[model samples]
Target: MPSPLPADLTPTELVELMQRLTLEEQAELDHLLTAGLPRWLPQVGPQTDALESEADIVFYGGQAGGGKSDLLLGAALTRHEHSIIFRRESVQLVGLEERVARILGSRSGYNGQAKVWRLPGATPRILEFGSVKEPNDWMKYQGRAHDLKGFDEITHFLETQFRTLIGWMRTDNPSVRQRVICAGNPPTDAEGEWVIRYWAPWLDPQHPNPAQPGELRWFVTDEEGGDREVPGPEPVMVGGELMTPKSRTFIRSSVDDNLFLQLTGYKATLQALPEPLRSQMLRGNFMAGRSDPVWQLIPTDWVKAAMTRWSPRQEKGPMTALGLDPSRGGADKTSAARRHGAWFDVLVTAPGQVTCDGPTAAGFVAPLVRNGACICVDSIGIGSSALDFIKGLNLLVLAVAGSEASTGSTVAGNLRFRNKRAEMYWRLREALDPAAEPPIALPPDQELLGDLCAVRYKVAQLGKAAAIQIRDKDEIRELLGRSPDKGDSVALTFVSGIPMPGPARQRTAREVPDWRVC
Candidate 1:
């Protein structure tokens, strides 16, 4: 039995009351009002929650068969006046087109060539279906205005493409709500990993301050393209201007949330797929396909464990070294890391736009360089300029060039490196090993974690000797879609002969002190 509706309510009062109703209550009201008409409505659970979400950006799907595509179509059909749904390829829109045709009962309003559906109503809503496959394909919709933007299987598109498309999302109609809805499962490869960072509050386990599912968080982008989270959704002063932060939230969806899918035996089909795809699709496990590649120099687990041990209030020794990676200009960032014994402080970074020259980068690094702290600069390309300026100031500085010959080898002397870069990176890897002395602690910075774990290495035989060869920086930048500035700064702190402070362990006669490894 259900409660009777209040009698003689005004239209405005009824609308306000409907707005305050829970999803289930709203559904009951819809059932009573329409008298079971053949109108489309959101299926209960994730679909209803997604349709009702007020977030500026909402990530709506995780597991397979979660009614992700249906939710996008349903929202466009009912709520939006002008909307666009995107897929990685135009061919992928076939199923969605068929669904739209069935829902509309005819293709009379659809323009096949333009891929736009014009629904006749009081407002005459428009829905567009499109694809962005190539790098510059997103430019096709440069100045287009859309109130509702949908990206299905969002991880298939590059982060740059997704961000660029969202820039054009706008509408002047007050009654038309604006929102970005993205749907996807866990990334199947490294190229898709940026999605995890974009939704860090909900997806990233290593995020310093994790957010609960569907919790609204506000973020504003700084000049250097880094996002800074503010306390609330209110406007804040940034660079002498009032900037409003956008609200974002992620809602996890699963097969169980879709009653129709559950009854259709789709879960069994997902279970039969090969791992780690099975885990990704069945349980929506984000870590499923993230197994360490064979050539990955630093394991993800090792970096995560080191981050877990880090604390801002932990006791620290004197600053042993400061690593500086300068960005001359362009999109790269100038980053610095301060090392205290085995503990590393959070990375400090400025965009290339601000730190454009050597003097500017030096200004940022000067405060961190104290007495007895060796300022280690990459000294390659623009970094050479910063190194020269630091040396002129009469401060102790170490110039590190990746192309230089390795000055040291492993404790066993069996592992030789092809270049100084290989040796320095390997030293950091050894320090992060489970049994390494003076356990390393790293700040929980998601960007730094990604950079460190992105590197790949190989053992090459150089005639009579085998030398470890690290993949070139250019190659790494291509893979990561940005410079590995943070990782480079951290690795530079391990320049040879720099002593780090840590707990001393009594050693047997056969044991050699492990201090040199750090």
Candidate 2:
């Protein structure tokens, strides 16, 4: 027989029902019995909503510590029996594995897991863990059946990895449809591009959330190279009571979101290191400036002029050194700069030097070589392109080898990358300090200026004594809200200890017109 409909109780009825019950009964009614009911979930603001179609793929993207992962995990538990969770890195999966195991075993932890659980009178075995760091690792679950598949930190994994895993989740639950759930923060320097292309449209700020009523449409590609459009369904409010397909479901939760975030004060201690580290970790941001930024204390007006359209002209001097941030043809930028003793002239060469989006760094060095400058390009990753490019240039293209960069001018392989960056930071700090009286003027580039502003310094303690240490590269990336690669390249120029060159051709008073008089 069909279960009897729940009595439609009004606010008065609810109060009376609670008033008549005993303490134990009232507690049960308030929390255990009525909590999952749609009426009790609180209509304060937009609540947990679900996407339409069990077959559809859902993506939840934003800052860290948002209720995103928590919601995904809760939804996955609904299909307990055939739920598989995929994490990009083994380290992240290990954290999830430990949490799940703890819940299943008898423990002292709160019983929140059981309070929300409901099934067909059976404590069904639901949920499994898997990873895709290496494609072959997915082989272990060949015959696995899952109604729900969750990809945590989806941005970290490649698109191909996600597609391959979804194909494996063949579910048996007739009631529960097969679907994929993804949760992650925004893209970083290391993130791949396809995500920004497909998923970005749906979550990008430009698109109205909940998609302007009927205007909202979700599309899926089918077997035949054709596309079909589907209407976005109101989200299934998990407890079977409330159903909302409202577009206001997206919520931002940062380190401030997690109540448990306080447990990790180590991240907070990082603020003492430098401005770059403090900004990156404390507030989830990225920067191109590392401990030693390329453009330290550069004037604001200089950077503004560059952005406005400063023509790139060969400096009228002997270029002493060159700065290069090689690109791998992958979103990163390739940059080169010629340092004349008194001023530095930088060229983007390709549009992609500030963001990883253009020709490889090695591919952009011909100009510097022709100028007979000492080139210091990043030798990290596919930096070999820089090496090959420089060698082919037959000029003085040297590698900035330390741990990153492929250029040949690396330190004696003795110092770690962090240490080398620290050394550079020390030198930069010295130069920028008013007491040191640095002579060079700041360049006119936004990217360089922003890195300088975001940099910070802190003191480190060793037992009874304390010494100051510059922030690390990762910290710099976080503070700037972009990759600090260009800043690092600039920093390398300072560390190289090569003197800035003077003008190759002398300009007589006749050639140098005093514009002030005109």
Candidate 3:
């Protein structure tokens, strides 16, 4: 529900209303009152902008130790006269309550039972501390109303909970501007994927479609499609009358932006995290995780840095290759990944030609292979047909029989990979390693990143030799509710015999032989 503030209300009225606001509200309103401005540090200037603007929702977060918690608290304080701040666990509020108490000092009266600190008056100003630990806890707030609502460590809550609470951000006082503010650290798993998706365009510093800091974008909820965002508030006919679009703004700030934290060793601590975690926490990367805990591959930071250096050029010496993973079921995806130098970001998937066998599919594949786009196909299920068909054509294609024995990269001792699939995937990891030059860049693909993260490898003994066996896509699909088709497609690109970068003249796709269709 929107605040009761009239569109035509004068600026003077808004100021007069804020003057009598509770201490919490005063903290934030002070800037507005003093100079009709939102005071802020350069580090958190955008945060202030979002809070002061008419934007209904604002997400101020990114890298850890960005003073996100403090900002959230301050924002809550500014609106505390009619405010409610949330923490995931009710217990977490105790520490925050202490901070609130120190700020309120002797001017406030607490009522723990009511979860509120009150400044008694004919029109009393109050600030409340609360929690919504579990999704169901939201039910307790069904009838509550407040102009200001906040969520700290928002990634810890469920999407449904956040949605439900938004419905409660209503107030009779237009002077008490209604705002939803949230803060959190970088997410670590697929569970955080929802938050990432909601804020992706702004969260990704490299996003092609950048949402400027403090700019608002609107989204509408649909019964069929859920919530879909719009570039700006689109006018909607509500009972023959136009309605304003509700908007959201996400402000991204890293530890480096917060001078206080940067002055401490916190930034160094975040940098010390391993691989993807370091990137996720330090860079405030939303797409960093989305992998299963047990199966994460290709450190996220390594991938992020490599993406900056990704050049879609075939190396001068090695041949660029395409990996194909045709869908098994008729409607399943047939994903294809293009390996340019050592990168796996270029991926494409197409459906398999049903009833085709390895020997016959080779006829169609020969033309593509002859054209210099070397092919690597998954030889499992219907793919075996394409594999056999292409092999008979005498084309330079890798028909990967995943279950086949591992043949490359001998172990330090008796350790070995379980099958060809393991060897291929392990090599893909090595290719993504930062030490490998001409860095690999993946497509800005959330699905592919998730797939890569979902692949879990386990070591088991086979006849006195230890071998690593990667989890199958079927297993991964259970975790992600979809096949890792894109991931497998890239993995296929690494099959032995595929061309790799070397010292030679660079070859463009145009240089290959013309395709001879089957």
Task: Compare the candidates by TM-score and give the number of the best one.
Answer: 1
Per-residue lDDT tens digits for candidate 2, residues 235-315, read 443323443332212233354433233334433564564654455445534331234334333333334333343344555
Query: What is candidate 3's lDDT per residue for 1-518, written digit by digit as tens?
Result: 53777877643455456555687876765555446432323233555564566778889887787777667666665544677888878888887777766655553587887888775655566778778765468888887988888888888776657877888778887676788888887777754655766676677656667787777778765322235565577776543456566888787767765544544558789989997888778887776754456546555555556556655554433337877776544324566676656555455443343323443344334433323566788878878766655544444566788888875653344457788888888777777777766546777666666667667787788777778788876676655545677888878877677654233234344433222211
Give the CA lDDT, 0 to 100, for residue 253 in model 2.
Answer: 31
lDDT string for model 1 (14-81, tens) is: 55567677889878867786676645777767778878988999998789998899889988999999
* Cα displacement (Å) at residue 302, model 3: 3.3
lDDT of each: 0.82, 0.48, 0.66
TM-score of each: 0.79, 0.41, 0.50
Clashes of each: 0, 46, 21
Off by over 4 Å in 3: 1-58, 62-182, 188-201, 208-210, 217-248, 252-296, 313-320, 327-334, 340-345, 349-374, 379-405, 410-414, 435-447, 474-482, 497-518
So what's the TM-score on candidate 2?
Answer: 0.41
